[model samples]
Target: MDVILFRFGNFPVTVLEAGLALGLFVVVAISVLLIVVLRQSRSRADAEIRASEHTHELEERISELLRTQSEMTGRMQTMAEVFGSRQSDMMRAVNERLDGMGQKLGQTMTDTTKHTNDGLRQLHERLAVIDRAQRTITDLSGQVVELQTILANKQTRGAFGQGRMEAIIQDALPATAFSFQQTLSTGVRPDCVVHLPNGAPPLVIDAKFPLEGYNLIRNAERPEEAKQAQAQFRRDVGKHVQDIRERYLIPGETQDTAFLFVPSESVFAEIHENFEDIIQKAHRARVVFVSPSLLLLSIQVVQSLLKDARMREQAHLIQAEVGKLMDDVNRLDERVRKLQTHFGQTSKDIDQILISTDKITKRGRNIEELDLGSLEELPSSERGNNQPTLLNPALKSVPAGE
Candidate 1:
């Protein structure tokens, strides 16, 4: 068993070499471990500085993105304002055009209404005038009907008959060529007298209208009354014929046949049909029953005769005037012959005077050879004053000129 111990210079000394060497080795390992820990701590501090620099770079990029977004929002706001202003101007122009069109439409509608109203007013006025004219025509028609009624009665029928007869006579002959109610020397007055030409006596025409009994017969109700009235009418016709024969048929005083005028055609036909014997009696009595148609024929015949007589008289007067005109023309021809004879004689006398003047003018051309200085004689008045001339020659035979 060996044991080791060390001893230092202090109090006790022992020798232990192995244990001392182990202690020295442990001190050296502890120093190397402390140096390695210091180097690891320095490397941790360098890594922390690099991480802080990276964090600062990220913050700068975020701030630049925010600035770009703000500039874009400002430009969009300016574009919106310009578009709103242009839209307002377009809306104002459209409103002004619509107002002008509305005014023109209103004026046109008002003018059309006024023209239609005026046309209707004129039509109403024309209708009123037509209505007034129709009323006037209706009133005139009523008056004409009343007047016709008054002219068809019995008591006033005589005046109407006279007027109708006068119209018929006037129509047959001109009233200016005829005289009515002319009285003759026999105290008989005729109804009409027609004057003729060439100093012929006027023709006498009597108007006798017998219509009383005829009217009674026309108005009879029963057949027996009609027969009785017809019989009375026959007697009345006969009496009227007799009366006309006595009043107007004066031989040599008036015409041979007297005119008995029946104004109505129906009355004349009745008298001829039922009273033929009365007409024969009238013919025997020199009374001619003349209807309006027959009277017109007779008047026309008389007028024709008068016209022929007038034409004949005019022809005679024209012949006499033609004979007188022929005499005047013969006298005018004789005066023209005498004037031509006087013109021939005057021409012969003028020719003889011209020949005598020519002979005198030729003899005067030789006056210078006849001693013209001594040929100057005294004046004729001095010679007459010197000698008294004999006032008268001896009155031989005593002719009238002498």
Candidate 2:
């Protein structure tokens, strides 16, 4: 296959030379390819070796991680157990504390309930008492209103005073000791007349009061009006005192001093305080202004005097009873002396009987030791004299051998 392809510049080229050149290029390409394959193979081998070493290291790390994870798991389990036990203990303690607190709360609530009930009961009782007190206050208010109504009317007010005086005298003195609305010797009727004991004149009590002028004095606001009202009150009271003295007093039938009974203590006090001249004039006229309390005191004195008089009248009866008691005591003493004499005679009789018993006892002893032969040895006169006076009839029939 030698053929001429091209000519070199200085030499002619043959087909054999072109063929050898191509063959040489092919050889060089083959060598280069072999070199490249060998280098790639060695690099691959080294990479495989490195990959195996890394895999071994990774396996070792995974095993170590597994061991550490197991240890952590065990520690976690231990911690869980410890926490569970602690939780159980805490739970038990909390339960116990809760139970105790519950009991205490229950007991406290019960005690509070009991105290609430007791307090409510006491409050109800107090309310009831307050209700009763309210009722009493209402009654008292009604009575006060009624009294005011009575005092507003002159006749009723006088009747009220007379009634009060009558009640006082009737309560303190017997019906015989006092008389109500009694006509005096002068033909004037007094509210009360108290008969004193032992020939003393009767005491007069007049219950007519001059309340209008006193009410005027109390109601006057201006000083000038008050002065006029006080003067009027003084005149009214002085006139009342004079009327009582003239109407009730008598020389021998009634006491020289007569009581002008004022129903109210306040009215009497007002008269004495604001009208001193009235009191002086009243005293000089043998007239006495007496309030309810003063009248009661005088009545009590009269009662005591009556009591003393009754006691004096009963003194002789008591003396007569004492004389009869002395006579009974003398009779008792004489009877006791007779009983003592009888007791002494009985004692002497008992002594003689005891002496006879001693002699009988001596005779019984002699009879007990006596033989039939000894009985025959005794004289008949001595035997008859020696026989016991107190021997039983059955013993008298007993044989000497027995």
Candidate 3:
């Protein structure tokens, strides 16, 4: 390596030269450093510019996001308001429907309760009526048992028959029209005697009927006992018929045709069915066997005959009343004729008065229709004159029918 030195005024030349060289070197180094620094500065400036551009892009993105968020928030608020309104409407509709259902259910329950009460009342009334009918049937059964016990005795049965005959006769005829337990010609006491009103013969009713043999036959368990009871019934009936014929068939006292009154219709039917020969014998003896119903019919016929006889006896009094009615009718007819004559005379007088009133009214109308203005046109002396020609002589002669 070669070394050189230089010197300048007031100092070493080599030093000055060295300084110059150093300055040169420094200048060169500075120029190099300036170039490196300028390159680094430009690089840094480029990096910073890229970073700022990136930051600017990010800020733009954030602003866009904020605007989008604001738009979304406003939309969400509107949707929430619409949803709340829809929810409120739905709740109100559901509440109204529930209220209506509740009211309808309440009314239906009340109506059903009332109907149940009415049905229960009607059922109670029907039960009460049925209970009353049950008691009535129980009492009727007891009465039937008592009646069966009473009819078991023969003497009591006879007395019962006699009493029934007396009651029936009294119901059919007046008390004076019938007699009970009357002795006949043969000393037989008949159950009933019916008096005829129109001079007819007395009717004798024998009520002593043989029911013991009939009852025995009815209650017989064996055929032989029933046959014997039937035979006894026939004998008893034959004897009773003979007695009726002997005692009641008096031609002068009672009717020639006598009645055998059996109080029980079942007993009379049994006799007719079982004892045909006895019925023939009774018929031959001029004795007619009559049941209670048949006897009542005969009594009704007797009562009607008696009523007809009584009406016949009062024929004179009825004729007298008819005569009095005819006299009253004739007197009323004469009075009506006199009243008609008076009406005719009054009508004639009213017609004459109406004719006179019509004539007076016509004359007064003619006098009122006279024109005073026309009369005033005449002389005043003529209006004041009382002469017939001065007043209106034409009104003095009115027509006859005016």
The C-alpha lDDT values of all candidates are 0.65, 0.82, 0.78
In order of appearance, the predictions have TM-scores of 0.46, 0.66, 0.55
lDDT of 3 by residue, 179-205 (tens): 887787678777788889877778988
Summarize candidate 2's per-residue lDDT along 1-402 as a digit string, tens digits. 223458889777654555456556655765575566556656787675665565566456556655665665566556556666877888899999999999999999999999999999999999999999999999999999999889989999999999999888887888889988888777989888899998899998889888988888788999999889988887888888888877788898999999999999888887788678888998999988899899999999999999999999999999999999999999999999999999999999999999878867766876775434556566677777766343334445544543
Whose lDDT is greatest here? 2
Which RMSD values do the candidates have, in order?
32.1, 22.8, 27.1
Candidate 3, residue 206: Cα displacement in angstroms equals 2.2
Which pairs of residues have clashing backbones in candidate 2? none
Overall local distance difference test of candidate 3: 0.78
Error of 3 at 371 (Å): 48
Q: How many Å off is the CA of 159 in candidate 1?
A: 3.5
Of 2 and 3, the candidate ahead on lDDT is 2
- Model 2 TM-score is 0.66
